[model samples]
Target: MAFALQGRDQSLVALGCRKRYIRGPRRADALVGASGPAGSGRPHQSGTQQQRQQKQPLLAEQLWFDEERILVDESFEAAEGAQLSPHLKVAKHVGSGTSADVYKLQGDGKQPELVLKMAKPVPGLRRAFQREWMLGRRLNAVAAAASELNMIIHTGPAVVSEDKKGQLVFRGTVLEGINGKSLDSRLEKDASFCDVDFIMMMLQQVLTALHKAEALVGFQHGDLRISNIMEHSTDPEALQALRDDAQTWQAQGFVSAESAALAKGLLTFKILDFGHSKINERQARSYLKLSSPNMNTPADSAPAGSSSGSSSSSSSSSSLALQRLPAAKGPLEAFYSFWYRGRSDSWRLLRSLATRLDGR
Candidate 1:
């Protein structure tokens, strides 16, 4: 599908543009006291107790592809009155995945509730967190003005720390906490309150945001499963009030005021987990080349009508279509081609969801 950013959304796109580089806070910066272990760092149960705990089913977020754990520096902020400093108070560990450890955070009175995602300190995993930080910084730059377009969680200022050897390390990232649950959580339980229209609207909102991201900076969110999609719990009454306030402002010819009012909590669906995202033209080209179907397979040179060739022909045709997309094509052509490639896992996920919804 050829998705273009709407003209009206141009300003919205610029609203989250991070044009400048953001430096992490150094040791000279105020330090939030090191976050202590959850409730006095008690030891775990032994033998059957531990085995029984392991036997229990994992939460949606905890179900990572692997369980190799790595210890990392968790003290990223300074201490303040009975709470962690830097405007974030660590609440508790929420979940863990191969990429990052997720934690719920209680923001100081001046800040909103947030989540902290600390990447494992393993060498191979460093680039993943760096990519996520880069993308988040880009999105966060515009969040102050384009609150509605702040679909992806807003990350607070980067907190830096040093290892024992004196090398600087990215302790973790603090992100805006959503008032609602992930789509997986909702889908696994009673979602009767959200009608089909609402669900579809949420889907549309997410796709629109993705399209905007592609148009502005050629970002492909590599992970788009149900767990990565968050539906905001913004109340209907609050939304309605915002609409009313916007209308009132509009009537007074205060166009900017109206937009500001409407932008408040206008976001419904947010696409998360850009840890695997491919950013910009170079990365996109590399991804396409890596993922293109039948790049040099035997079927590419096989004679017509054979079963192998016949089956591969369909896949190859799609690949050919992507190749044939003109180099001088419009801004969205690259995004379209990338999404249509056979290895586009997120596209497959969308298709699966559509099939399931259609069946229901």
Candidate 2:
């Protein structure tokens, strides 16, 4: 099945029909702004009144403007270290999902080309939009661990202004676009293409990625299907040679980790579409560790088709609700507990692979 871009238009927002949708109110009632500088001392004033006019040393005087000015006129400056910015010129239609549209960015001298994901104008989809943005930020936050990641680098959101009121709106994000086709695309062309060797190599890569992904972000690869797995475009000749000699590679194998570098790169895939991926609200980094003793994959666990998210919320104000996961403490330990507990990202990946193979 195709992820958002390919053919799956279904959205996570649409799935949870009971969830609340924050309506877009016409105006923000109040903004917590800084107070004005202290008046030179009113000796006769009451203690309470004195507090209201308290002098500001480091801060400037209160510069209150109409509420409209705060939101409608000003664009949100990117958070201190964020890669957020206004949308670049769109080159063409890349794809559309239930909540957003993806586009190829126009070339510019200042930045490498990126893919822009713009949220649909519908207000109901805001949370889903925010969820994806947050997920990207989470992944990028730990990108130094890139040696272990397979997901694309999420640059951040696109900003736009409404034509009617000129209000600055956070439209969506910019992504590091890759030259590629989905695993599904690759499979659809040749069902028998994924021989044992190819699939096994891909599986190894997937497991490593999921392990790190769970540690840094989460376990539920909400949509772990063929469409979300990108097979980077490779030299046709090189690819044909590998495909032609799959059995040979399978039998002989690589002499070293460095051997068959080209084949590895071609078979290795990058994952995308975080719109449905969920994470811990309290501390994402600490919760999905692979070190927990209870996280091992069960030898007799139910097959991939069983439902995953079965755990309930642990505390008030926030709920984790991980998939069949035992309470995990850190990425190293957490992912292990996730594995031993009979459900994890690896399970989902294998399940998806199994389904794809069956279809093929």
Candidate 3:
């Protein structure tokens, strides 16, 4: 797998991460004011009640993964006074995915090439759009904190709105255009990344970007395909810092020993098209509430088919229908199973970069 861009998803067989997705909104990345205990599950510290103080704030967004945004919807938005971008004018349909369709909207020249990603009224429809929208913000937040990555644009919130093709069938999200094709396409079209210097530049840019996302939001781009990476930009100040003080970034643990070098020119990349991403393990465990999954109890972590109770099927609420996963052992782990999982986005990044080293 090459470090390509466009965020087009790939199957993560090792992590059991699926490539397909349905479209919808997500409340995952939203910050609930950083207060007392929140989301599902208890904290990592061993505590009954006294120690569980105000460490974890309740983030309703995490529930969207287990319950598929059922806790919040358009009505929820309305009650909360969340602004909605309804009746968007789409120029044309560019592509289609397993659960959603991609379109390009006519920009007013000042900011042209905006994408209008839409999903059908299916089960995972809202989740698909919400994942890209929220995860994109998390990525952007990382870039913002780093003076170097601030120059690039990942994406904004998914202003998803329900439309009526007949009976309210169409739903869509607006995203800032990623700009450019896949890495393979870029390579075949032009050999910009054939040099070791360019490879090293790409390595640093991508490594730092991944590190920021994981560190801040506990996000895991499980479907780390080459196409998921794109040619992004970085501030000259930051790129220069990487070159002059490679040791600094190394000490911070953003880059591996093998990729301590830097390229002469600026090269930045961002992970896009998060159609197959999930929250990380440690972060996910923070949501271990009574209703959420329990790692100690295998039945609580069991899938819909294996679980003795048809809790998902037997539920009367339609929200239960949209809820994808039944149990979450930790916080985001409710979205993950109790089995062996992978958390090596950095290792995988290096492994994918190794493709360029074939026959060397």
Specify the highest-lDDT model's number. Answer: 1
Q: What would the per-residue lDDT of candidate 1 be over residues 148-265, giving only the tens digit for each residue? A: 2356665554434435553434445666667667767765674232233334345455654565455444666666677788765444455457556756645543333212222333
Error of 1 at 310 (Å): 63
lDDT on C-alpha atoms for all candidate structures: 0.43, 0.43, 0.40
Better of 2 and 3 by lDDT: 2
Evaluation by lDDT, superior candidate among 1 and 3 = 1
List ranges where model 1 is wrong by over 4 Å. Answer: 1-86, 142-148, 191-194, 235-267, 281-349
Show where candidate 2 strays beyond 4 Å: 1-87, 150-153, 160-168, 217-219, 233-267, 282-343
lDDT tens digits by residue: candidate 2, 205-231: 555465555554554555566678876
TM-score of each: 0.50, 0.51, 0.46
Off by over 4 Å in 3: 1-88, 109-112, 148-153, 162-170, 187-193, 233-267, 279-340
Is 2 or 3 the stronger prediction by TM-score? Answer: 2
Q: In candidate 1, which residue pairs get closer than 3 Å at backbone N, Cα or C atoms, i.e. clash?
A: 15-142, 16-142, 31-78, 32-77, 32-78, 32-79, 33-78, 33-79
Tens-digit lDDT track of model 3 for 4-80: 43232333322211222222222111111111232212212223222222322112222123322111133322211
Whole-structure CA lDDT of model 1 = 0.43
